[model samples]
Target: MSVGWIRPVSGLAASQIVMDDRIAQAEAPPGLYRLDRNWHCDRIWLQVRNVLGIPAPRVYGWSSSTDNPVRAEYILMERSGGVELGKIWHDMPWEERLEVIRTLVGYEKAFVSANLPMHGSLYYAKDLPSPSPSQFLDSVNSIDKGETFVVGPTTNRAFFDQGRGSVEVNRGPWPSLNEFVHSRAARELACIDKFSSYPGQQGLFSGPNQYHPTRALKVEVLGDYLKVATQILPTDANLSKPTLWHSDLHSDNIFVDPSQPTRILNIIDWQAVNVSPLFLQARHPSLIEFEGPIPEGFEPIILPDGFDDMSEETQHQAKNLRAAQSLYKLYEILILRRCPEIAHALHFRDTLPGQITGLASSIFSDGEPILKGMLIQLQDEWATCVRSSIPCPLSFTPEDRTQQKRLEASWSEGVELMHEILTEVGAYQGWDGWVNHNNYPVYKERLARCRENFLDRYAKTEEERSQWIQAWPFEDKTHSPTSL
Candidate 1:
């Protein structure tokens, strides 16, 4: 396949090409693209753009005429010129930052208006055969049982004998919360754990088990939290209407062109795009805090007060951000309530403040104390749930026990080593001025070592281990000079 004179443009993982120097990209074959391994959602992006008539890079042009089969799989897209909104947010004037937020909201609204299929609906087909009708019944029989079906990676059909019978179908477009929870819980948990373990300091201490020092302690805490989560799972009334969403809208995925101000130049990596209710989209604090602290001597484009001053205009945007974050906790609870198997495997329990605080801390890294307090309150609430005789929604298995223990130990040792390295390298001189003045090379080297350790300890096989090592250098190599 020939890419028709397309040339390389800036990108981290996938091959980005500019078509004819004007159109900015040529088409490529499906499943060959590697920005993300999951190619299922990429087709969705092509479809969405086609339906909306948005001027996206061309796709599906692959043929023998293309010079490179690999290059032909992707469309050449014009590289938008701008700094990432994350980098400039803190330094930009407050109004400018608000403008960016407002722009993001508009983009999100546009996405929802497109009425694309929800992720679950796209992936899980009701007409598909299952191994057993009884198995499908099991999924619908109870919340906890349904969750077990949801969280595991295998499609529902894989779990039962399709030859035996057809599974019962729901009447509406949206799956029941029970069904969605069961269907998605496993993948979400796996993705969280896997990505959190990405070979870098940035990935560490960012998930549910960060609080405890030992595996037992972490599991004990998690076990209790699961019980509380189950109790707090939003009922049917809380379920919102389904909409198209960039389910994985985080800092790295969104590109900003400062010149465009109101328009985001590009939203990249649509691997996780899915049709789902707004409620299912998880929040990430890093995305919201794109404009972090500004460096000295650099002229700021967005002012610090913008977030505060533009609060009125951005209140809905802020609410969406908050909702995204809080939904994770809600998911944790719903999964536990729906799937006793997960609870048994992980010894999950419902703790009130502990889970909430832990989630908040993970989201807002800077607000540790407040998050910690919230976690404490969550723990107390779990105790109340226990006393009330609500069926405890947690269970654990030996594998879960072992993994939990290993992760806790890894975290404690990693944090200690990180502190030592930071202290020796002078990276922690107080949050306000420390990151700005720190030696970046030293930080990068230390981070690389941390990544190595994480891969060595947690990765499943040698090949899997090697992949992470290869992926690490790209992180350091791809950033622009102005990024720092």
Candidate 2:
């Protein structure tokens, strides 16, 4: 098992044993070439827990080698003491929920205020290939035992994906935020040169519309992103400061007391931490993310005019949504009061440079159509894209815009199909024509039926039906756009 229970040193908390068993994973790297730095990934993250007052499970003991009796690199932690936030959240009164939101935002304020010297993951000084104990001894606060944590090469998977894992790329404790972004862009550029031909990301969307996504299109869009990176990156010292952030802060990770509902005991799953500039790191936490109307700045949210006329169920859903939106606005308001730079960075997503940098970060996964659409929109709204005298660097012809429209439509269908796969087919972990032994026969039969039904209902002609069958996602010879 990748996870297990452990005995905590303290009687006040439970224990959680998380093990990064490389040998157990189906896709672990070859032992001969796997970097030693990677073995410390799960353990080194906790270095900040004590310094930042982040109430996560403490790492009692850990190892990066598999020579021990257990034959694995494992992390033992003091598990959180309280119940999951999901258990008591929806059932609580409005005041209790607000308190929870306030507590969560308070912790975030601490995170944003921490201005570190570089962008990278935390590692012990001695664990590095060439120990530099004297250099980064002050990166994070020292442990009580005199052990030091150092800022080292980032363990972010993006730098390693698509066969770039062991290759010499600038995965770094980047001295500047701009350098971090440049290195990421450069890595993606290198991948494009190696694997240029990728089909449009249109898998699993059971739809008839199809459009070709090209490497040329990706290059054109990424070039504009590069222009933003090099020339228009925010120069404000506050925005450029390398900060540590927890990327996945959801309700499930947060634990609260069942007796005193407002008390948050601890938060779990801090493994997806990242060290990037504040502009890229600021985002609404998953707990407070809402689909309802959100106002500009710290504006107050008002109930809709027809709330009294709506159905009971609709009104209930609307009230819940409004509460969630209030939580979102409250988070911004709290940041504005405590750390205004981070608050400003929160709204930076709407600006031209922000959009470019934001979209560029996920370009490899987001693919062609979305990037092309952003470029076209920016070009069309040139006057508003940039507030200054600098003209927009991108221009596309009408024909290019028209093709982008088709690609967008196809991409939307693919997205909807992916949702269906997640909720309906239970492909939540991502399916690549594979299923567990117990479900293998059942999935195979269901897939055959789905193929026939899709072809019969959606295919325009005999040739189209044949092509659709050949391109089906859950079968032999499945295609992956980002596969190395």
Candidate 3:
């Protein structure tokens, strides 16, 4: 596929001329051309127009010549000029920046109203070849170890065999929350059982009175967290409809036009779009976190309230940053329910407990005690959930009781230490200073000691060593101002 056209203006002509001079020179009309795979380009352009309500670019159409048997498709559209919002942020005033954000938000609203689903694939643990019939059958056989038999009618079987046999069976296009939940539940159950029976001679379950050495332990722990998460699941099924979403809404995708202060532009990459809940689209942190600090001079744009208030010119640029922040909190809670370890371990790791502890301290210093306080609350919640789910064993020896008590004490101590750090830092800078300040050497040192202590006690035994090795936590390496 290709987009080719005569340049509408001299500026584009100059650019093409310069390009031609630098590369392979061609004496053709000054025009722009983009070559890409036909189906993919067509799908992307169609999706953008459908979701954004923009007209499809004028296509010169498709052709296949004897010299080139492969079909070639082409689109020609007038080029719109604007600076990428990321590059111009610092130059733009604050007010203009806010308008840009508002415009982006509007685009999202329009996409939602169009009823087009965002498209993205979810990662699953099944070791299947692909989401096709062959892989599904293979997975079924692995689990059941039974003789495989084709059960469909002869004609149906023939059709199935004739189709691409290697295509992986996608769990979606799931159009509803109910479908997503049901499918995920089935997948979760399969994973749980698979991990439970995993074979390893030195595994945690090998010895009498030993614990399960599989990653199943993390999954089980995460499941306990999910019991609380269901409370916040959206009950309004009507609001659960799929919407266009940017699966990777990084900073680079946003573009702003200084001339059109109220409008923002999106590159509209359909490859990362998905049909998921509107909430999922809103909850994406990358949408807001990208671009770092709002451009220096740009005024903050206030997002329009509802879809009705949006204009075609500025709709895609008007996302409500504050609302997005609130949605993120809810998303955090929901994600924790589905995959607590994967979610929390990204921030909180035993090897780098200080990263979390420092976060607590910074929150206190920044006058947002609520942030640090959440950690203590989370710990209490975890303890309560564990106590409720796992009953106390009457047959436990004194040593077992002592170990349990120590575990509880350690958790409590961690909370206390976080509180203490917050308080000390809070007294000097207050909460805001703690948050805004770039350094935290003292907190880092304290965290290092705590991590070392944890490793010494829990990672010493063979079983503990194996578990620790298996639990791959993400590492943090940001330097605190205190370190500098």
TM-score result, candidate 3: 0.39
Segments in model 2 whose C-alpha atoms lie over 4 Å from true places: 1-45, 66-72, 131-146, 161-168, 196-209, 296-299, 377-403, 416-452, 475-484
TM-score for all predictions?
0.43, 0.80, 0.39
What TM-score, to 2 decimals, does candidate 2 have? 0.80
Best by lDDT: 2
What's every prediction's RMSD, in angstroms? 14.9, 6.8, 18.1
Model 3: residues with Cα > 4 Å off, grouped in runs: 1-44, 54-81, 116-170, 185-213, 219-232, 257-266, 284-287, 290-484
Q: Pick the candidate with the highest TM-score.
A: 2
User: On residues 282-381, what C-alpha lDDT tens digit does candidate 2 reach at each position?
Assistant: 7778877767667665667777789999999989888887788787777777778877877778767668667777777655545667777876776777
Give Cα distance to truth, residue 481, candidate 2, Å.
7.6
Task: Sum up the clashes in candidate 1.
Answer: 80
Candidate 2 C-alpha error for residue 184, in Å? 1.2
Order of the predicted models by TM-score, top scorer first:
2, 1, 3
Which digits, one per residue and each the tens of the lDDT, describe model 3 over residues 366-479?
212222233334444543423445432223346644544553444454345445444543423222223212244665455456545544655657776666545312124222
134-169: candidate 1 lDDT, tens digit per residue? 223221224443222211122122111211012232
Of candidates 3 and 2, the better by lDDT: 2
